[model samples]
Target: MAATAVPVQSRGDLVLADPASPVATVPAAPQILVPATLSTTLDSRPLDLSPLAGPLAKIAQIEAWLGTELIEREEATRVALTALLSGQHAAFIGPPGTAKSLLILLLAQAFDLSKFITLCSPHSKLEDLMGPLRLSQLPHDIYERLTNAYMPASQLVFLDEVFNLSGSLAQTTHRLMNEREFDNGNRVERAPLISVFGASNQIPQTPDSAAFLDRFSFRLWLGYVSRTNFPRLMALYANRPSSAVLRVLAHNMPIFASQHGLLTLAPPPVTLGQDELFSLMWAAAHIPIPQSILSTLDKLYDDLAGKGIYVSDRRWRQSQDALRVNALLDGRGIVTNDDIAVYTNMFWTTREQRVTIAQVVERLGNPLAVAAVDKRDQAKTAYDAAIAAQADTDLDSGRKMNATVEALGKLKETAQSLEALLAQAQQQAMNPTKIQRALDAVQGWRKELSEYVL
Candidate 1:
């Protein structure tokens, strides 16, 4: 056989001549690199479910001290305690003399030393909260001393005038409030069993930041005592002992801790059921709400929606938790309308909002009672006039007019009756029977309004 001619390999420009030559494969396109950045987006953030430990006895002691001084504030304090025990923070806002600070100290004194720590000031620093660094005293470098001084205990910290802190200091609190940890150089230093009791003369117009606001699970407005409770408060103030009952109660803090500890670890979550909805709807139907009042409710709902404020889905489920506690305090197993009424007040952003919503519910429940009786009289007059004018033309007109006048007379009577029902329904000493009767009467008038256009 003739010697096979050796095939010469081509250089850089060589092309494959064989049908079965291996094809050149291009490397997969490199993934677009994402720059490392801090997450500011709230949606991606995890739920900060850090464990919370608070002395319930302390909360009860504080509540007892509040006594009858500030009924609204007292109720608000109960709600706040419920929120705190459930592992949440509360922000109490009020005028200077509303006893906001007093409540904080009272509550703090109730906690076991291991469970609560109080820090008050306009100049509280992160180091003060986490613990101080001992640079010069340390055998190692200054930074090493700082690393050794971290306190990791679960204690309640009371930050009075919390809004006055510098932005950096506040930012550190924002982290501590949410994550229960602070950035110490390269590592995160967890706080020892930490819970914050922050009080302010007024809630900041704009919170230090959204993160800071989110850290406070409940926001309460503590107003002055009701006029009815003023006398009792005065008596308590005038006869103030060397140590008030609150102090005595607080001194027995361990009793509260034991009682609180006995409370079921996880109480059932709060829920809005048919009874709540009916009670609210009945109240709404009876009250004659002004357009302005309706607008306020709408605005409040919108604001809460926009800011993602109010209770979170998980916490919203716990909104009714206070009801149970309130009931337990009152020695009841099932929550009643009164319990709900008191608890709902705690969730409102302002006194105006709470009063307005209550008014709307009242008006909706009994429109006749809420609407001006004089206006209905005027409407009756107009109807009578229209009937009289038609009477001269036809026999049917005279009969119809007479019938219309009779109907107006009956409506006036019904309206007066409904007004009485409404008065009883709104009474502070209202009973279930009266409320139920008022609800029935109001429902009747609503149906009547639908039928009688004039």
Candidate 2:
């Protein structure tokens, strides 16, 4: 049957006869509390931005641009961007010459952000890192730090040798990273921080050090470019853009930029404002995560704990947004097994657990899980839409609401088929939880809609 569009009416309700079904009215629906921005996050529509690389394009563009020069640092760039999308700090731990500092420079240049970049040392002073106090304020009995372009005042920050911070610098940036604020005189000033990307050779194994590291949601292990890629790396370094060339293209290429050079304009910063970044972060927060994958995560965590590998309670909670952000970056609407493959970057706490956790996640991988999850989401969206239509006062008559009633009838048919799919999944010894839940929801919707069936 051909489906007709639901006509908009001015006075009388224009009834839509769904060729698909004869249902003309809907039953009472429960008042669904839609989440605010947060609820929109939970009830977030299936955001499909595979074409546009999602809302975090600026960050994605930075990652891609960095990848052009950074050899064997793909994971580092990816994890770093994921951390930003998750609105959590990240750490890069590797030996010198592993491009930790270089990656920082490239990343900072790839986008135009108010950044505070510092090379940390044992002698690093808080006054130097966050900025020195105003000399004028000292005589007036005010000790305000002039925090312009400093750690507390920046959006994207990079602290190389992060573990070498002096006591005051460490303590202050800790608050800045975690609390998003800085102590200025007797009061604290809110920071416009997105995430702090830190680089370190090693993490000191003290409880205090561990606590500080915990502030970062991800820590990617950087390694030397493999012997196989050594030739390419060497060639890359040989052909690397010199500071002189960069300056010429940036500062001296106004006239010749178009006539004889590929560098047309000075590097146009691929930038996003704080407002847009916050909105993208919120959109990233809404990316769909499936229950089956989450269930697998539950099993993975339990498995890791059994092996004496405990991820922190806080990390456990934050991993959701991280996973969702990973999905958004991969140009997908929902988290998948491919996105979860990056779990190694998130929860690997120790050298041994790194390999062990990878094995565990591999063992728990379910390729069919995403398909089931997606189907369930589709059913849920259909069910929710039907309910919302039933409750809409503007849908005043049978004609006005028939399209939604028809959707309910279609959902009923879908539920009948899903019941069989659930049965087969159960027979296969797979966790049919998602499919079963989806069927139950559609069944519930059908039951309500059937109350008014005539």
Candidate 3:
């Protein structure tokens, strides 16, 4: 079925209209103005600027933009964006000053969506997250919360330090995050939320918020840049002004112009409509899961359970949605080994578990990498055999020299081809650590090539 168009009711507003229902218009919500100065030099990496044809292309654009803007966070950004496309929430676990809040805010503005953002605290009131209640006409006894322009109406929401939400506020937000519906004074109102991006310095400790924490599909742990990249990070920050400095001199169009003009002007067109996105998500959800992956998941479930990090059955099922999105975006009809890497983030409880999950997933999820290792080993054996054959005194000198040259040439060619393969893989790597490991291996091989200079 063709997707229905859910037009914005007001400027930058996205209304949560049922896909089966006719177009519904709601009052416009207030927009949050983000300064154009917030944008930095997107990485110089080649970008696919081809015209976007659908929601998938829009997501690709966002992914490319994220790669350019952030350093060493490609995997986390991709997962978070996938969660958003899948109509699921994501959480970033990191200390302060890690660009978690900034990235989410930038994404909301990039899509021109209305947003409700706040720093969560135990003292946060319902009126702050939602809205205050008001009496109705001719019935002082009847009242309703004024949800206009609140979290209930916004398209994107960000809660910094989300673990601090407690008591009744936490209970309300828990329901809101889970169902996308909030309780007003007298009725339940559906929120127009595409995704809620949450950030916290620590994991939720209180029992009350743990269930709320489980709602996030992608949980990423970020930290300071590594020593190797720290110099590049400093150069980027010191040489140029951070993108967040708004410097627009638009004295004319006050209605349409602000520090945000730099961001709004001639931005990339949004190709995916809400209906199409939802439909794609529906399709992804139904994609077939192979028994092998199911078995791998079963083992993973038992492994994590042993470590006291239990993933609920529901989470295990919903996790398929992310893998499905990954396959769909990659233009594959079925999920493959590459998609299993998502479990690293989907099932982990702490940063240490992230390491364990990654190692396990690499072993079980990537057939190509495993094959490459085997092939490299086989090539090594063949090279050694050729060298041994050349060393045989029973052979003629002319033939021996020829054989030695031939063996050396073959080994060099093998190393060169493997180096080229590593280069290609590095281009698509979401995780920098894997790419670095490949690079190290290539360097070691290059050094060994010189030692074979017989």
Candidate 4:
């Protein structure tokens, strides 16, 4: 058969040699290719990089208002302020007239206008805090105006006598403060609020509710001004009207807020160690801690435990962070022993425990000094009397004299044991590390007691 050239089909069908035969395999479809080297064009515009300015000069003015004599409660105030700036709620508990409301007002002034809201006692309500639904005359129907009427725009909210609100209202406010959102009848609106400062004359004897208490992230105890600061405060009050001072404070608000932020960013200069942790734990365990104090510690411990309450380890890692914040305000980079003492003293606990621990710490070095001296004197007096009696010779027989001496020795041993226990308790406060050493010494002494005839 003569070879015939097969013609390729153009735009029309072509006859094939065999209709049933499989058509030649179609060539593989061509893949659409993308360029590998497409360059990203740069605008080449310079960034408006500007150095951050330090806190406003007004901050210095506020500090000057605070004056050179500082209150013992100032440390607690700083910690509360920092927590507030971090968008955490705090409760300030103390007797009335400790400037708790004034502090909140100052905090409000520190923020820009419209960023701080102050709701004074016995009058604040849920609607006052979260805005109320207004009926517009034009629309002839109710419309929700998320008004910033009483609410501060992008700022903190201070509620004085927070416990005064009705239970339902307080619960609603608590939820909003915690979740940052509120139900406005038809829809939920999230507010720009950051911190909520709640102050009361006294800690609610019975807390409002667990839900309410949980809303606060920090708790602080505000106390009367130190004796050192009292005279200065009195002089300031005597010389200037509170209203005029408030205006000055208002003018310096921005600066104060900026300074506060700067202080917060500064690294915690102090690191709490094992000894500090032990001291804190000892104080916490012994002291009758207020609800507010417990709440604060619980939050701190929760943060440290990574939100788990059942961790096998009890570490004071969170306390280290708190210590650092404390040190930064104190203007130091390294935490000192003094810092630990100061912080341990600040945590709120029962008065009895506070006094006891303070006494223990104060007498750490002299735990046995007074008692040992008295003991020695008594022992000497007894021994001298015993010798004197032996000189008398005929009153009692040798066996009776020996028995009396042995009883005196037992009395001495009892006194010594008591001295050792007192020393151990004192050492536990001053330096927990020395506790084991003291314990070992006590055990050795106890073992020796077994050898005594008594």
Candidate 5:
């Protein structure tokens, strides 16, 4: 497949003047800055993060808790944490039963963030998402959306099958995410939203839909447990088939709490509280884009452009905040080229483009890991295609089954090659973790393919 072109805007400049560096100022958040005083009296003083400390210190515990017994979501867990802690919108894409919903709920539950959750469809209306207008205002010829506890008023939002939204609803959502304000007819109300989360099984290809997705600064791709991780996933859930996080997210807290024969268990690790979250946001906002980091990003932008991947200027600027927070998550005060890997999630608009970004990031982040990452990605794509082929009733079962076997054979060879490369990288004492993930993926996929064969 030919590479798809993403829009490139001239405003994609990355240099930050020394005097105007973000470190010296508290970046403004409209919600806390000059938010509307809803009928709920939401408008008030701006956020002051000066006194807050160690938000990054407590995030690992949060990540570990959310990741408990979840399969193949190590990187997704970090992306979720970064999106939430950095207060940026993100989209999670994966197949059903892949734990996407479970993961988001755990993140939301950990922070106790006020959230509005809904499923989108072709018939979904704006009123369904933002809520009905104030009846009294309608009488006064003012159509004011009563946003109490709705997407516009909540600190976080999770929309399932978000791409199914009707054109009108999608447009309204685009405005709400990009502007952080709702057009109330009589007034433009500042939203209290910290982040808007979206999930889908596939990427949207239409221009408008692409624009809607661009509103999200980061996108995470989740896959099923590989042959390698399947055992771990099963071992963790051997006695119990369903996810504990699923039960909790379903409002079955008591049932979830009592799942084990032992009636009591220690409390799971947690996010410090909403106040602590505010402080983390404050601290993260103050993290500066050092000239060197910006310069690195500039070169990265060009490299991606060379490969026909174009990220909008706005996306890059917004992503910087999240990257800074990623640094913070590592208990670091400075940003590094290592952090550029986060851009891997930000640049791709389609599944095919994802591998390109991965190869690019891995190449720059760790050259030794590139071949492994590329090989593993190619094998996994073939394996995924084979799995998908079996589901297509139009295809000849005999032919498809044989093709799947061939794909599996190739995947096994690739897995062994990845293992060899991983060992070489490890012996060289280069970053082995990257290659390790690749090796795990192909090995797992190879196992998955074998199961399909049987």
Candidate 6:
């Protein structure tokens, strides 16, 4: 079969079309900086990444907005934005009302891209998702969407209740997610999709949907807010006006009114060139993976396999991209032990196994750092236990005093040891961010130890 020729607009420009209209051109640049390219070619060609100098800054702005807009979702927001920068799909698994769908929409607004969203179900048809195919206007034998206002043409797509999609729709979606292309009743066409954001209340239990689930490179498990943040969350949403308040409310208003509101209430001033993003992605794929992490992953695979949990070799390779992308987000040109935090999302097959996987990754990523954290946590637990024992009538006051003293001594020793380790790490750590984290932890431990009573 001959490769279908898509007319070139600009060398790296993303040409926007109405899908219903005969030709598509780039949209007019609005108030905020314009976004460049969404999808790269299937051949894995390096995308032009010249414009990426500003993306990290832009991403930081979006992350700040997400942190304030959604309570307790700072990490999830970063993961999702990283997926966008890497030009990969992300899925959010959580109960409804956790702002899963809202995050995707907010990103679309920030990028000023066309947004397409659908609530998927078992009964959904291909036409419902991709739009109905119609006879082509051109003489060639082909079929295409009658309208471009569907998932295939949109820059950002959100498929809520994605796991609920069943039958042929699920299979079609799997192809869409993997290849970013689908047969349009006549010929295969490239999807103009940039990033797909899927949300579900649970992971797929059935074999069919599970395959589709694996296409998402970044999968985040979200849950309810903590009790400590519940009241503050309520107050923020109820009494506080967010940065997104004006734009979100104007969504349903007239186009002129909405555009004006958007122009005035631009989310972030930074822009990411399509070429620059693609170049970064190419760079990330080649970023060095430490041999230690590779060995650790191999052992982790064996350990998990022994427990009847299995990960495909393909998933393992794709996970490398996640690590590289994480490194890029951390402002590193190279992958380091610190980036192994990516495994916290990759190594777990079950939600219950997440904590264990996190611990394993933390130990492998930075053994000394993890050890310090563990010692501090243990000291805290011992101190808390001693205080509770002191309140008990059965425990003698002298015994309680001795226990408290022992716990305090352990805390002091651990704090001092961690401080020494932190000082040593600062000289050798490649990533300054990781070193600073160790420094902060050591300082926190010292402060905690200073609060102890004789």
Q: Top TM-score: which candidate number?
A: 6
Better of 1 and 6 by TM-score: 6
Report RMSD (Å) for each prediction in the order shown: 21.3, 20.2, 12.3, 23.3, 12.0, 10.0
> Model 4 over residues 386-446: C-alpha lDDT tens digits?
5565557566666546745654674466456655756665654333323333334434433
Q: Which runs in model 3 stand beyond 4 Å of their true positions?
A: 1-53, 135-139, 242-276, 306-308, 367-437, 444-454
Residue 136 accuracy (lDDT) in model 6: 55
Error of 6 at 45 (Å): 20
Which runs of model 2 end up more than 4 angstroms from their true locations? Answer: 1-37, 50-60, 241-276, 366-454
> What 10-residue stretch in candidate 1 is worst by lDDT?
44-53
User: How big is the RMSD of model 1?
Assistant: 21.3
lDDT of 1 at 444: 51
Judging by lDDT, tell me the better candidate of 2 and 3: 2
TM-score of 5: 0.69
lDDT of 3 by residue, 47-84 (tens): 11111135556767766776666677887777776787
Measured with C-alpha atoms, the lDDT of residue 205 in candidate 4 is: 51
Listed in order, each prediction's TM-score against the native is 0.47, 0.66, 0.68, 0.45, 0.69, 0.74
Candidate 2, run of 10 with poorest lDDT: 25-34
Runs with alpha carbons beyond 4 Å of true place in candidate 1: 1-72, 113-123, 136-154, 183-194, 207-211, 241-454
Tens-place lDDT per residue, model 1, 56-136, is 233334466555434446556675555544445677778887877767665544443343344446566766655566565
Measured with C-alpha atoms, the lDDT of residue 140 in candidate 5 is 81
Model 5 per-residue lDDT tens digits across residues 1-454: 1112221221111112233232222222333322122121111112122323344546768777766746778788888878877778889988888887777776776675788999899998878899887897877888787888888888889998888887667887766787788887777889878888889887887787777888888898888888856778878767663545554544556655556532222234765667567656655554555676677777778888999998878787788877778766765545655677788888788888998888777667567677876887799789888888888888887878887898988987897888788788777645578788788777777777787668
TM-score-based ranking:
6, 5, 3, 2, 1, 4
Q: Please name the candidate that would achieve the greatest lDDT relative to the true structure.
A: 5
- C-alpha lDDT of all candidate models, in order: 0.46, 0.68, 0.64, 0.45, 0.71, 0.66
